[model samples]
Target chain A: DAGVTQSPTHLIKTRGQQVTLRCSPKSGHDTVSWYQQALGQGPQFIFQYYEEEERQRGNFPDRFSGHQFPNYSSELNVNALLLGDSALYLCASSLATGQGWFLGEQFFGPGTRLTVL
Target chain B: AQRVTQPEKLLSVFKGAPVELKCNYSYSGSPELFWYVQYSRQRLQLLLRHISRESIKGFTADLNKGETSFHLKKPFAQEEDSAMYYCALSPLGSGGSNYKLTFGKGTLLTVNP
Candidate 1:
């Protein structure tokens, strides 16, 4: 398995523009999560998707949205991007198992570097 | 609100010396803590999780619930061990959708030769 894979390793956008990042989960994985890591900071949870539905969401604004396809691939779409939106966007995938202790064990991708001007 | 804090932004130590990366958390309920590491030009990966009670690459972290800390430590540091380390926490059970992780800012460890 290639673990998790993200598209467009780098991106550039200006204010009010939109962007969409894609992610393909690891083989047999059923859940996908997105995170944003700003400069000099750790990854912050953006949202999580399971069964093609958003299962959990973080404190991000409404401008940030996501979708999960039947194949477990996911897309993160940002509308009206702001300068602060510049950061590394990460996608993580894991099995949605009933095992609570291991649920958060996610495998991350290389991450897409988004630069907003 | 849940939060993880890594007290040091950067830590430097010589080879064969001991090193410790401090982490403290603030969460109301039982949390699953984990240590993640990122090497240069590599993706972030899990080093260890509290529940497993295992060590990776000679690094071990003991979760102190009383102090709400999961500090990663190593007795003998090596140049290969130099990387950015992060401490993360997840709520034990939140309707089976608690996979979200709260992470610390991270500590950049530099093991000098």
Candidate 2:
């Protein structure tokens, strides 16, 4: 089975530039979430998209936003990027809501490593 | 707000030795805790969740609400066990909204052959 897939496995951009990372959820999954993982740190929650709407968000600023399409694909966009934005962007998909996650595990994509110089 | 904490930044153990990765959390409401592992060059994957009360790859975690800890433990540390581990927390009422999870700073496990 094809698991979660993310495009642009690695990206390099200058400060103040914008970057958009795409994610294809695992087959049979409908909810998508994005996270940021700094060097030597665990991934931090960014926001979650379900049914084409942002359902929940973390402590991130407005620069980070996301969209979920009808096909369950997701895109994470970061505007006015700064050097601190350089980190590994990970995408994870699960069934909508927290239901049955106790039964089926959350699938994760290989991640897009973004480097802002 | 919910948060996870992994006190150890790095943990080292010899082959055939036991391993324990500590995880703690703070939240006003009920919490769902999880342990996720990321092997070198691999994506982060769920190892186990407290609700399941199960073990994966010889690792197990028990939730102690009184202590607010969910420590991952393994009987024997294999060379393949070397990886980074993260503890996560999802708060109550996540079904409707607030589905986002909070993760800790992660612990890097190093197994010496």
Candidate 3:
């Protein structure tokens, strides 16, 4: 099923510039989430999208926004990139059920390594 | 605030030896714990979750609410088991916050032959 897929395995940008990362959810999955993993750190939740809307958000600033398309593909947009923003951006997909979104397993993609200078 | 902690940054063990990866969490409400693994050049994937109570790739984790810990254990470590393991926590509820995962720094396991 190709599980989850991400584009542009690696990216480089300068401070104050904006960057966008893309992700395609696994087949039949409707929920997508974004995470940031700094070197030597685990993935930190950024936000989650479901039904083409942002259903959940983390502690990230407003500069970090996202959009989910009807096809279940998502995009993470980070404006005013800072040096600290240089990290591995991960995109995860899962199914949303009546029980709870947390009940379903999240499948992750290979991740996009974003380097902000 | 919820947090997950994996004290060890790196762990080394000889093949066939028993191994345990420690994980501690801090959360006020009930949290669903999970173990995720990332092998070399591979994407992160779920290894197991506390609720399932099932072993995956010979690894099992037991959640102790009193101690607030979920440690992953394997009876006999294999070389293939070498990878980066992360312990994550998800709040159990119906709110939007419940969908996000809180993850530990992760433990890198290296099995020697």
Candidate 4:
């Protein structure tokens, strides 16, 4: 079975530009979440998508948005990116338990390295 | 606000030596803690969770509620154990498909043979 997959292993952009990263969830999984891992730091949650809607978001600004398709794939869009936005964009997929408590194990992709100059 | 803190940025150890990575969390309510690992050229994956109370690859972490910490430990380190280890925490009721995790800065473990 295929695990979570992300596209465009690496990308380069300039300040004020926009970028969209994609992710396909693991088989039998329905929820997808996006994270940003800056150099020398662990990942910070960007947002989570469930039932085609954003279910939870982190401390990120409005410039960061996401979409979850019916097939459980996801897209993370960052508009007007800044130099600080340059980081490794990670995609994690997990099975939603529906009860609002205790999510199962999360499987992460190889991550798309975004560099904003 | 929930937070996870891993004080060590890098840890080096000789093969067959014991290893311990420290992790501390700040959360008012009940929290779920986890340890995730990423080896060179491999995707990040879960190593273990506090709820499971099970060990993986000789690594085990105990949730010290009184101290608000979850430290990963192994009796004998192996060369292949070198990787980036991350500590993560999630609120009690906000997990699963709708989960939002707060992660530490992570510690890079280099086990030398």
Candidate 5:
């Protein structure tokens, strides 16, 4: 089975611009989560989606938003990107809810490397 | 607030040496613990979870609820084992909150010949 897949392997944006990153959940998976990973740092949760609705969100600001499609694919949108947004955006997928067997077994993608200029 | 802690940013040791990576977490509820590993140019993958009590690639992590710790250990380090390790805790849902995982800063391990 294909693991989580993310688009545009790399992205570049300017300050004040908006960016959208895409992710396709693994086959048979219905949950998707977004994370931001800075260099040399672990990933920070952004939000989680299930049943085509955002079921949970991290401590991120309103500038960061996401959408979950019926197919379990996801999109992460960041408005008014800042220079600090220059980091890797990771997309993970699992087969169940946050309390399921894969609670901590999030399957990650190669990640979309975002660089905010 | 739930938090995960990885004390070492970097660790280096010769091949065949025993390796240990320390992790601590802070959460009032019964949190689930996990260890994830990322090798060079590879996606982050789950190394193991606390509930399973199983070892992967010779690595094992035991969760100690009393001490709020889960340390990853391997009897012998292999050069291929070099990678970044992250400790994470999934805080149990309570009231109206959905569960979410908080990861530590991560520790990079280097296994040399």
Candidate 6:
């Protein structure tokens, strides 16, 4: 099923530069979420997209944004990146069951390591 | 506001010993809790969730509402069990959306031989 797949296994960008990370959700899944995991820390939710609209967001600023395509693929864009933005970006996909937000298991990708210099 | 807390960052145990990773949370409403594990060089995966009351890989977690805690435990630890564990909570979302998860910093479990 290819599960979930993310792009550019690794990336290097300078401060103030912008970066976009892509994710393809598992087949048949309708929702995609983005998270940021700093070293030695659990992933922090950036936002979740469903039905081509952002369903929810975390405390992160607008500098971090995302989009979900009709095919369920997603992208996370960061503007004017700071060194603090350097971290492992993870993409997760789940089915948007009518009952609850996270009713089923979320399949995560291998993650893209972003290093802002 | 919702938050998940894992009290320990690193927990080391000998093979075959009992292991317990503590987690606590703060939320006004009911919470759907889950335990996620990440092995070396591998993507994160769900170990189990409190709602299902099912055990995975010999690991189990019980949610104690009175204590506001959901701790993951295993009676016999194995070296393969060494990994980072995260506690997550799913709260209700506004405007007909489900809230994004709130995750703890995580606990690193090392089952040494």
Overall lDDT per candidate, in order of appearance: 0.93, 0.88, 0.93, 0.91, 0.87, 0.90
Which sections of candidate 5 miss by over 4 Å?
A97-104, B93-99
User: In model 2, how large is the Cα lDDT of residue A88?
Assistant: 93
- Give the alpha carbon lDDT tens digit for every residue of A12-88 in model 1: 99999999999999998988999999999999999999889998899999999999999999999999999999999
Flag regions of model 6 displaced more than 4 Å.
A99-103, B92-99
TM-score of each: 0.96, 0.93, 0.96, 0.96, 0.93, 0.94
- What are the per-residue Cα lDDT tens digits for candidate 2 across B3-27? 7889999999999999999999999
DockQ agreement of candidate 4 with the native complex: 0.66
Q: Residue B90 of candidate 4: its Cα lDDT? A: 84
Candidate 1 lDDT by residue in tens digits, B1-113: 99999999999999999999999999998898999999999999999988889989999999899998999999999999999999998888653436679999999999999
Give each prediction's DockQ, rounded to 2 decimals: 0.56, 0.50, 0.59, 0.66, 0.49, 0.53
Please list all clashing residue pairs in model 3, or write none if there are none: none
- Worst ten in a row by lDDT for model 5 chain A: A96-105
lDDT of 4 by residue, A20-96 (tens): 99999999988899999999989999999888998889999999999999999999999999999999999999887
True contacts kept of each: 0.60, 0.58, 0.68, 0.82, 0.56, 0.62
Pairs of colliding residues, candidate 2:
none
Candidate 2 residue lDDT tens string, A34-116: 99999977888898887899877889999998989999999999999999999999999887544632214578999999999
Docking quality tier of candidate 3? medium
Interface RMSD for all numbered candidates: 3.7, 4.8, 3.4, 2.8, 5.3, 4.0
lDDT of 2: 0.88
Q: Per-residue lDDT for A50 in model 4?
A: 82
State each candidate's clash count: 0, 0, 0, 1, 0, 0
- Residues B1-113 of candidate 6 have per-residue lDDT tens digits of 88899999999999999999999999998788889999998889989988789999999999999999999999999999999999999874442325377899999999999
- Which residue pairs collide, candidate 4? A103-B96
